[model samples]
Target: MERAYKYELLDKYIDQELSDKERQELDALMTEDEEFKEEVEVAVMMNASFNVEQKQRWAKLLEAEATKTSVQPSQPTKTSETDTDQKETKVRQLQPRTRWLRIAAMLLPAVFALFLYLFLANSSQTAPQMADHYLSNRHQAPTITMSQGNDLSQNWKTAIKAYQEEKYESAANLLEPLTNSTNATAEQHFYLGLTYLYKEKAEPVKAIQQFEKSQQLNPAQYSAEGNWYIALAHLKNDDWTKAKPLLEQIVANKDWKWQTAKEILEEQE
Candidate 1:
């Protein structure tokens, strides 16, 4: 059934055995589905734990072999030629087993090292890939709400309608005037920033500036959201250093967005 196929795909993903196409599909699902994302996280953690356990098991086996090899029989101070020959024969008989053990010990460490290198490489790639997905999904226009009797202009209303309709160019053009106006509200500035992000010819740097202005105008209302978007903008621009501090702040605050921020930070590490 379809459900069984999905489970099998997930198993392949966790084992790092998925083909490129399958991996891409899974990555897309992870971005869109929170439960699926959490499942993948758990799977990765379990896989890493399993690898560690196997490494420990191999280490113990190697140690036991080493201890066995070290325990040689004591030789007599005065031994007959026949006794020496007998000892030599015994040593020859053990050499093959000892050589095989040494080979196994060397191969096991190499195998562990290879696994470690692959895990680290894969982990490093996961964060940047997730960031890309986050940015792509985040470009959708945000819902706009207004209070009754507010001073919002007709142009602002039109801009919101345009954004909702995915007419990002028109939305950006309409919001531009409000952004430049002296009496612009923090909400206007924030929406303008979102418009820039959604526009076809995206202006992420401009978006960042507008978001920053919004935060300055009304930190109490816009600070947390502003910080989150600014960090996302930096990520979209591939400026991880700039994004890191903002994500850390979100994580420290333990806000609603903290879980996602923490995941991004973990990927970066």
Candidate 2:
């Protein structure tokens, strides 16, 4: 009976919706059953990995909806306690093992994307459509329109303009060519990583790759940023063990990114 009960809690455990008592029960089961513990770990990883693409897709859907309703779009208005209670009741009636936790976790990346889009849109009123299209297509921005003899500052200005217009791909493409120049510095790689990070919703794999490249190219100051991206990649890939170390490094860093890194680490806990 205890063995059967432990199996029953698998879904809840994966979704992280188990009550304190139920969790305690699961701990006891795992202590006595190594196989059961491994099974639960696999299930949790599977759940996180399977849900990654779905979460990104939902973020795109929300982006499309927001674009369509551009003028003061109806936001995900904060829910009241009564509404939450009602939803919880409905959820219990329908979902076999609680799905709210999955949905909530899925919202994190989407919220980040939304905020990024809003920031870019507000800054690029002159080319709103281009910005929106770029974001929607998840393409990188083209490099600066530099005719020969353009100064470094001028090139960076162009890159910043592209970034402000939310042409992350273009910004990245522009910065990519510069990284090969003898004068290129760590800041360039860091900015390139920033471009990839912005497009995380559309091309997470690419983002991870670029972030890794940034770390390799500039380890002095961008190591923390690289580690943060690594953690996010691990989170997206459902490789908790792989992510934990990188997240720990970022959390320990006394940098501005630490606050956000700490928050994410806490969530995983």
Candidate 3:
């Protein structure tokens, strides 16, 4: 748990058991310490090689073992001697090929754990520089207004006008009450979400909740469009996990601007 490497942490790392905080700390160490960085790089390479070879070897050994077991003579004969020899032969493959390699083997798990743990953590981090690059540009406030309905709907008209004018806080306040009303529409929830998602003083978590509610309120009309807003909200928050599924969903459905969603997903890698 300390900044220095511990065999226990290494064991967990190799076993894919490190906590998120521990993994991030290891990533920071790699950036700050050259010696540690080199050790991790070497360990990662060696462990990857070992795992591949070990899997292949185990596969072949199991196949041969199964064949031998199946083709046994009808006579009830036990070959403890043959079994022992076979085990010894197979185990010999796991032994280090050289003295230096043997010494490194003891420490490799720690370094490799650090390397692998950080790699996994990297998979879910934010890419702020790319978040708004294209998706944000493509967005525009709705041209049509829903002002023809009752008094609750009339507030949405005011909210939309406030939003288009970039009066985000006022727009958000105006729309918030509308969502709690029995007369609330999916379109109303969606507009409130946009107000919260304004780049200036953005509240991305609130934005996501609103967008998801919009979807639940009217799936037929808002499934694709609501998912799109939620994805944008996640991007604004620099949350890869929340954004990626929506991006993939959009791409799979060939939704509006699906090509751009694919590009964003690729860049995340």
Best-fitting candidate, measured by TM-score?
1
Name the weakest run of 10 consecutive residues (lDDT summed) in model 2: 126-135
Could you report the Cα RMSD, in angstroms, for every candidate shown? 14.7, 20.0, 18.7
lDDT of 3 by residue, 1-269 (tens): 45546444554566788899878877787688788777776776888889967865665554444334344233323479797676665556444333345455454547544333322223344555455443344346665635744544567778878888888899899989988888788888888887787747889899888888888999987788878778887888888787899899999999966886887777677
Q: Residues 125-206, candidate 1: write the lDDT tens digits.
A: 5433444455555444545556632666788888888978888799889989888989888988898887776667667799
Please say which candidate is ahead in TM-score: 2 or 3. Answer: 3
Candidate 2 matches the true fold with a TM-score of 0.39
TM-score, candidate 3, is: 0.49
Worst 10 residues of 1 by lDDT: 113-122
The lDDT per prediction is 0.75, 0.62, 0.70
Comparing 1 with 3 on TM-score, the higher-scoring candidate is: 1
Model 3 error, position 12 (Å): 68
Winner by lDDT between candidate 2 and candidate 1 = 1
lDDT of 2 by residue, 1-269 (tens): 35566777887788678999999998999999999889988888888878966776766666554553333312333399887677666656654433443454455657646545543323233222222323343323335555733755766777777887987778877877876677776667666666765653434456566667667767776677566655665555456677677767776766545875665556445
User: Which candidate's lDDT is highest?
Assistant: 1
Q: How do all the candidates rank in terms of lDDT, highest first?
A: 1, 3, 2
Predicted structure 1: lDDT: 0.75
lDDT for predicted candidate 2 compared with the true structure: 0.62
Q: Name the lDDT value of residue 114 in candidate 1.
A: 42
